[model samples]
Target: MLDFTNASKLKKIEVNYQYDKFSWDHPGSSAQLIRDGKPKDAGMVEAPLNEIDQVIQNAFNQKVMPGAVVSVTRKGITVKEQAYGYAYRYLDDQFTEADQPILMKQDTIFDIASISKIFTTIAAMQLYEKGKFQLDDPVAKYIPEFAENGKENVTIRQLMTHTSGFEQGIELYKMRASREERLKAVLKHSLANPPGSKYTYSDLNMITLGVLVERMTGQRLDEYVKQYITDPLGMKDTMYNPDIYLQPRIAATEYQPWTGRGIVWGQVHDENAWALDGVAGHAGVFSTAHDLTILGQMFLNDGKYGKALILKPSTVKLMEQNMNQAFPGNDHGLGFDLNQGWYMDGLTDVNTIGHTGYTGTSLVISPKNKAIVILLTNRVHPTRNTESINQTRRLVARQAADAIPVAIPGNKNAWFAGYGDQKNAILQAKVNIQKPSVLSFLTWYRMEEGSDIGNVEISLDGTTWNELGFFTGASDQWQEQSYQIPEGTKFIRFRYTTDSTVNERGWYVLQPQIKTDQKNIAPEFTSTDWELRNR
Candidate 1:
């Protein structure tokens, strides 16, 4: 029921947001929740999900990351879970491989960098439900020092949505005199822009939120999270500053000589979080793919896992609602980033929510499909300088999305515009129409509006083409489109063009028929990047 089709323009271009389908309730099977099952048991296609292993292996083969662990679930069923490559590949900054490198396992823990914010946000929500503080209340009310330097008017909601106008970060590792002064340094930092005027993602916002939680609950952030969230959900492998005994199973992060921390392992990766003694709101939670999926399933279950109810169903709805309406494309909820096609990709929708970590970690949940994707990697291992894992995230997410079949009208085969970004692709067939005729076909698409677009065109001589109609956003359903073919038309084609950026669930066309005065003709297609697919 979340529709942005008529919402205001996104930056320079207009967007019409729509979903392929709609479902208010959890779209899951009637089986046990979060249990291991085959893809089809959850109404998912197995082949697409099977492709995930090769994708992760390719990342390892290319050395994009040292290791990775992935988990996928649909309709409350865990369909895929696997590990790849090495957890501790390098020994130093010179890319020295460890003599005894630890191979990754399904239980190998990872430094899930910024994902800690979601846990902090959930804890804060619990306190909010307990009437500890109102969201609109100024931070100055609870932490008096926050009122300094133009921050008195900043509300809790603004901080949660990253609109407090705080700078991204100040590098507390270099700025702080001691670990004791870190909080003081953060409290005294000045605003970069007037709050409520801009949406700048800043670690300061979540750090401050962590401090607020500690102040209200009279417990450390890690202690509070373990007691309230992790412990109750039975996420045994998730924690802050993982213990010494767990180091052998933990993945290594970047090697930092500047901070005198060589080959960061068995500890927090973020220098700022380390400055805070490996516990902060923004980072420092180490977890495995299996454990993270439990947390994800909790959200898909409306904040409940089994008998434990972590949040009210209404609260979860509020957490998914977009609060930064003034900033068009930067949609955000209480904690999670919303509708981010950059990483969410095919799973990106008005209701799809997710979060990403700096150390190559991501969690995406689609409420409509009742699906969850967890991709954890030690991409920063040996060094922070490496290839971006954004595409890998998108491809894996798209695989999970493709597994959920769209109901092909009449259950017939359809032409799929193969997924990619920054390309001009065509699916065309030479047609000899001596007289005027009507061409009709069915299409279903959800693309990046104003950027990736699909067009139906015809050419008199198969070279110069004229557009008949175009589509950019979601079609909502399989829509039948008809156009009049001219007498001299020689080529009928569907051309799809995309910008160099995020890709969505690509276009699908089915059952093309041309009706003349005599009879209906079925045309054969020669495509550049289209596939004949059965949805």
Candidate 2:
């Protein structure tokens, strides 16, 4: 007696704060294990598991650095946590007792640099949630001094989204004689672009935000962050200034020529932030992999932890929304960078959010999938000539993405069949049906020039082919097209023909399937061979 009608639906559980609020210390339940029996094994990711080790090994092998730290989590489970290589490479070469190799640890503090902006943004958003300020409110409303230099109307949202039109950067470390002077310089600076007309990523925007937070809260940026965000969240290792006692454990950074700062170990690396005494909204925060993972997970949980609503869900959504639509691929969300495929390759979706640091650190959060990847590296140590770690970032994220299985509609894997080489003939595929049925085909294709044409065809026999439709394949973007099969056709085949000798990669086909049930008849194929020819 099979009781098919009484099958129960799965229950949803709330496990947002199963781990600690301030740190990733909670070894929460595994997201993969929980979903093992689901229709699509979404939990299974194909990351090399050992790829983190390979990245570390290659860094040292290439002499890019001596060590690095990596952490990844999905849904609430910490899938990978690793530290590789020596924390102090110069010590290994010296051979002295005090210069012995120091292995990197899970809690190793990294000068996260620009990745700090996310935290600063979170703090600002917290104030916004409290009604301390509205996003479109003029900056002069909070800091009257900022009204100087015809910049009175710049809104808080503009600063958060890098649409303030301020200059890209200022060498405050070189120009200002004092911290007050530096703050004054930022306030008085005028627009480089029209406000909100374009996205010009400016450290000045965040630096101005830091000043605004102070003016509104009557507190230093670090003090404000500690009281409201980190302290309540339990991120003890996160701060603008690392305790002197922890200096020995901090990873080293660039040895700057300015001011003869020998080796920037355990200190803020940004010159302007250093001039401000190691506290700025745009940079100068130090934290660990464990601490950052907690922050990332908080966002994954929709701005809550253990019954505490740190941010309204709507607010978090606003933070993740892409505001710079004018700039197609340059995705920017309020205070957070979004959809950056170069570093966020596998981790990016419409809701994927994260930021990168100039000093070689990145945090990617996928709220839709509940995944996070944290990579910390001292790529600029000893010198800044090391290779960019963007490829490694992409590989790690791609591995995580590959692990999540995609659910096909009919429990059948989709097929992509297409043809076209650079030179002569066209590339195509064919399908045949004996009676009326549903046919669906989708292809993401592009070509080199305007003459490039790739088309779809349905034929009855192997000899003669009839065109179902034709499309200009020269779209700059991957375009999708579909067609239906007519009744009483014995065979159907698809063909892709390119018009010119260009570097053509053809098209990517997805989920091509046919439904045969007559009662559930598929959509009609309005095109006959003659109609297609006439068109």
Candidate 3:
């Protein structure tokens, strides 16, 4: 009976992929799989990341580097395993002396830069499900020297959706050439536009798809991603360079005194994947926040794990859908980067996929909350010009998206729209309404569309306001709203206008009625940035 009603296997997994088209909706609710220490054997709920461990110990007490390692998982339980501050605190790049360092643990080790292009786009979709080619086949159909220059029409789905305008890497370590002449100058680099037209986040398109998966598997792209993706998912500490006895739980990154490679611990820190010898499919990998949460639980199990399937839950639901609809907010997916509320903050929806790593990492998976949220950091340990781990990657993805709980209807009270950043929230009421009134309730929202919203105003004079509707998309569930309160309306509200970006699971209101013409007003309300919780 474990079919779990597959809902026709999620409608054969992606027929024009529509998880409600995108205002966010996914896993909506269902997680159970944690064993022993039991998140009640998986009815899930443990996520107390003590404000994500005090925002990674206040960004390592404002030094911003010197260590971090976080892990989280929701549905399959292991809630949050943390560790912060110095995985090998300085002995060079002059973080001045104290080299007895080594504390951040729950399994240290992380370079994870460019999240190694989604493990080389999941080892080229496990070799496009072993049929080998045709993702619109074209990087000159398996590197015929990548069709020199005009890039012979770039494809493999526009290099897994960075939209292939290619121009983000090839600095092949200040070019003294040879790494096959900087990979043939990234196959004759030129087009920074016009190749699926826009979005250009390239590392020479995954170092030419890791030399077209080492020329379609003559081996070596780290031995075909450790023999078919991390030794069939066991991920023994994730790889791509680990010889020198894992160097005391490896962490440190950047201290490269002009490529004389001063202090980059345990190798691989993206000097164009350490000049290509470190296995580059765009940044040499090195993992461990629970070995990248077992590859984000094999992408929330769409690609199976335990009995190891590799890929194909309709190609892992086409790698989380949104293939750059003409680059709208760059929500890629194929190498996963969908719904990025700037580092998946408040866990931006569209089926939440993730990837971030230029030394200070990020992973976030949330496959509709079958969740995962990594966050590995060395922030650039000794030095890479710190400042900007994008606010601890949006505060550990808004504390694992405010520990996922917004849906308080029958379990009691509601009316909460409180997240932060350039905020403004409301909940006012003073209705005497001498004539027409209707206002029933039960609303929901998820802002950040053309810059946040959630309004439902009206006023007579408690400060002139007017629009009685507007809640920017992403209902993902609740809805039963109404409004029409004209005649003598004394005032009524529910505002919530933000813009300092990324907020979801924010707006909600519940069971409020109000058929007033005078008597049944049921007023008694007046709040700001809104809340009346019973969470």
For every model shown, what is its TM-score relative to the native structure?
0.93, 0.73, 0.35
- Inter-residue clash pairs, candidate 1: none
Better of 2 and 3 by lDDT: 3
Top-TM-score structure, candidate number? 1
Clashing residue pairs found in predicted model 3 = 66-86, 114-357, 425-529
The candidate scoring highest on lDDT is 1
Which residue runs of candidate 2 sit more than 4 Å off their true CA positions?
A: 1-42, 55-65, 91-98, 409-535
Residue-level lDDT of model 1, residues 86-149, one tens digit each, is: 8998888788978899989999999999999999999999999899999899988999999999
lDDT score of residue 272 within candidate 3: 75
Which scores better on TM-score, 2 or 3?
A: 2
> Least accurate stretch of 10 residues (summed lDDT) in model 1?
7-16
Q: Look at candidate 1 and tell me the lDDT of residue 106.
A: 90
Each model's Cα RMSD: 5.6, 10.9, 20.0
Error of 1 at 306 (Å): 0.6
Cα displacement (angstroms), candidate 1, residue 4, comes to 29
